[model samples]
Target: MRELERYYRVLELEPGASLDEVNQAYKDLAFVWHPDRMPQDNQRLKDKAVSKLQQINEARDKLRSHKARLHVPSTRAASQSASNPTSQQTTTSKTTSRQAYSSQSRTPQEPSYQPPKPHPDLTGKDYSGANLTNRDFSGRNMSYANLKGANLSDTFMHKVNLFGADLSEANLFRANLLLADLREANLQSANLIGADLSGADLRGADLRGARVMIGDRVQVKLIGALLNGAIMPDGSIHE
Candidate 1:
């Protein structure tokens, strides 16, 4: 019981908090204590953040496991109650009627996917290893930001300023970077698979070992963009 309470306290939640609340608290705390949010020069703070994140993750996992174990007993009781011959017949009848009614009713269609609204200017922010998939960050000034190892899959960053940003090892899978300013950005070993870089300025950017091609065919667009002094995927320096 004391251990359980400790986990809840780690997540900043009260005892007996609902699973939804626990999950939400975990997400919020993870974002707050993520190492990328701290200054790279500050090793002390960054180490603390890393330690906090690990604790948060552990707390969340333990709480979830406890919740699952608690749920199993209730489910077993429900099953035992339903196993009685009289109760089984009644349940079957009710289930058949409900299924018939549901068949007659029109099924609701799932909502279409909507792009995320624009956020305030995120210039120079640290979002390393963050899951920002399918978001629209078009025209945002994120210059010199630390986005190393961030998940930017399917993100629309058209015309965004990422000048000199540390994007090494970041996942840019299918991201839209049309006309964006990526001058001198560190993209070493980054995943640029299926990314749209049409007309984007990547002058002097480090692309060594970055995946910009698939099987000898260039999969990314560099139409009319500057690559002066940038390193190519093959470890060759671009002229």
Candidate 2:
């Protein structure tokens, strides 16, 4: 039981979480700790990420196996019931009666479908390699969008929702990203020189190999930003 609890903690999940919750947590952690999102030159951080990923995978696998084992007895009982001719006859009779009752109570109705209206939510959009410099995207919901290798130099993205977005190798030079929701964003090797990230929520964001500093000084502004669990530009995990 202690071992199982440890697995749940590794995945940031509560004990006794359902299988669906386990799968979701696994996917979220895997994406955050993926080697491709880490700096290739930082061997120490890369190794750490690998180890973390291994732990996450093991936790997910063990929990899945445990859940499967728990359902084995129910499965066996279901198979046994299916093999019993009398049980199958009784189940068929009940199912047929229910179906007949449902059909009798059913009434035909006209379709009331309406076409979906367009919205500004840009979740999961692919804008790779696009030149979007000097654009204003304030307060926009662009979560999980693919902006890899895009040129966003000098863009205004204040309060934009970039959660889980892939900005790897993108050019964000001098961009205004104040108060942006950038949690879990992959910013590996992205150019953040002269960018204003003050008040941004960067929790769990991967900034490995990102250019946020010049010489011994950080060129980008990170004042008032939330950096908990975020990998810094130099591949150091923020405490």
Candidate 3:
């Protein structure tokens, strides 16, 4: 179990840590060690960060796959998600989950809940391979929307609500998504090259295997997004 031990060590977890713990540790460490957050002039640190990120990714992948075989208590979530795939797309009310509020990016004093927008109602809408480039959909609630393989390049989606939207393998290159609410969104393998997500909320969002960066140091998609508590492509969370 040398390899297993290495994985656990890389994620900073005790050996035989549960799936939840592994996932959580990966997120936490990713946030603290992402290359983009590092100083630009520190080439040595950047190189080290790159290496660390790679090890973290490998650890998460192996451990997750290993945990899948055990089907432990946490496997219930995976089973449930498989049974009701739409469950992953449910629009989680911020006020409803008190635990989420405890770790919110917003300051304890700020009270700007909004310009109340509509509840996300686009459940399971398929827009596969569609060219939706440059269309404006700011501030609209689109929770559970299925936009797999869609071309969203140059789209104006500032402050739009995309909670739990599925954009897997979608083309979001150069899209302008400033302040967009993308909480719990699925963007696995999406092409996010040149996408602008400055100040966007990305808590609990999945970005596995996405083309988000040009190099080890450059942040292509997450240039200015509010990544606090966001889950990255490598299963790490941004602080």
State the number of backbone clashes in model 1: 0
Q: How close to the true structure is residue 140 of candidate 3, measured as C-alpha lDDT?
A: 71
Model 2: runs farther than 4 Å from truth? 1-119
Q: Choose the strongest candidate by lDDT.
A: 2
Clashing pairs in 3: 27-237, 139-160, 198-224, 207-233
Please report, as a residue range, the 10-residue window in candidate 1 with the lowest summed lDDT: 106-115
- What TM-score, over all chains together, does every model reach? 0.50, 0.51, 0.47
Show pairs that collide, candidate 2: none
Task: Report lDDT per candidate.
Answer: 0.81, 0.83, 0.74
Better lDDT candidate (1, 3): 1
lDDT of 1 at 43: 100
> Which stretches of candidate 3 lie above 4 Å from their native place?
1-124, 221-224
- Candidate 2: Cα lDDT at 68: 67
Candidates, ranked, TM-score:
2, 1, 3
lDDT for each residue of candidate 1 in 1-239, tens digit (9 for 90 to 100): 99999999999999999998998788667656856555657999999999999999999999988876654322343344334435446766866655555454423442323434767777789998899887667789999999999999888787899999999999999887878899999999999998877678888999998988888798876666788888888878888
lDDT of 3 by residue, 1-239 (tens): 89999999999899999988997787666645757555657899989898988889999999988866554233344344345434345445423343343445244454433333665555566777889986667667777788889999877676778888898899988776767888888889998887767667888888878887777854564545666776677778788
